[model samples]
Target: MGRMKSSNRKKIIGALGDPRIKPYLEASGGNEKDALALYRWSVELTASIQETLGVTEVLLRNSIDVQLRKWNNEQLGHSASWLLESPASPLRSMTKSKRKEALRRAEKSATCRSASHFRHGQAVTHDDVLAHTMFGMWKDILPNHSPGADPEKTENKNRMTLWEDAVKNAFPCAEDPEGEKTYWRVAHLHELRNRVSHMDSLLNVDVLDVTRDAFALVGSIDPVLANWLTGTSTVSAVYGKRPE
Candidate 1:
């Protein structure tokens, strides 16, 4: 082993902006060799997480979309973007200002549908609606009245209520009897996905746990899909190679 080139060394140090990596390098007394090793491990771990998260994100979005569509068609008789504004949606329970803001964000996302045409060479389908929308927008509609609130009050009142109604209704089924647990899990995974998508450091995160929770959510939605995802995932192999 020869010494690393000056330019390569500088690049390695510059990439170590993640705060979690600093302490390890400091513990190594600023040794360049150790710093490079730690940096490589960080890069490898981030790559592994990004790969696994890509699969999980798609699975989650698809699962939620499928269930939402089923519920909307069954209850509302139609399942288009207009369903967001339907009386049956939890969005109807938000305060006037909050409801406006949520709709505004959702509209902005809808506008971005043209970008999909440029990329995929096809018009955006109904299934692509959630893909266009941001996770924050979805989470915003979760704070409405409880599952069985009075329809009258739901229209104008914005009282503190059990926030799990959105999740329960969105994924209505016998699989998840209490949707609160699934809601929290999916919410946390959404936050993690945001961080990874923005190229932020995840050195402190338990990537394995996040992956497992994502798979569990998938299973809750569709056991066959979950098993297929598990068979195709490389996350376990990646975790096995973590720095010792």
Candidate 2:
């Protein structure tokens, strides 16, 4: 056995048995040498292309994101990242500016509409968006709710509380522990929006983290988004599926 393994040519010939080579050979009607050569070319192409471009270019290679349950290659997954909501896509635009214009009329007419009707899941007056926004704001405020509440005595309020009308109007009282949790979440999102409005910085890593958690909050979290993000969901995903 040791003598058989000593030849370099024998070792190269041995590679013909690699599991990955069979499919390509079957698909292309070739022998082990042909399949192996093709594999080497694919490897070179992938590495060369990545070096020619940047890492950012490859970020979208993954298509089978389990989370959003859609091909990520088709659309970016919803992670608490800075998404600019398109007013025309039949899905919620991550864009705040766009959502605002769509929700303007809804302050008076509280009706929820389907994503297909709008430019994207955004309409001028969407009750669902409004309600979600309201919830999000209160959640953000939960961190510092109990600063000074005795209005009769006119106690000094926390500096954070006086930041804006949105802080004053949308946040829930520090007292509602159970309900406040939910409200604070909404408020934190509003705060993030505020940060964006102020021309602050955003992080994609942080965005992915936020997306994971927010997905849970919205019941849309997918552990598979990473695979999709990595482009591992192509043909392999079908094989990954269990027998029906």
Give the per-residue lDDT digits (tens) of candidate 2, residues 1-244.
3433335533664664555455555644655445445555444433322232222212211110121123222344443311223322322322245446434545334344545645444433223443323223223222344345352431122223222212222222223323334334334444543443433323111433333233232321123433343352122232223121
For model 1, the superposed segments whose C-alpha errors exceed 4 Å read 6-8, 15-24, 27-29, 73-79, 83-88, 92-124, 138-175
TM-score versus the correct structure, for each prediction: 0.65, 0.24
How much is the lDDT of residue 100 in candidate 2?
62
Residue 45's lDDT within candidate 2 is 36
Best by lDDT: 1
After the best TM-score superposition of candidate 1, give how far the Cα of residue 184 lies from its true spot, in angstroms: 2.2
- C-alpha lDDT (0 to 100) for residue 150 of candidate 2: 50
Q: What lDDT does each candidate get?
A: 0.57, 0.33
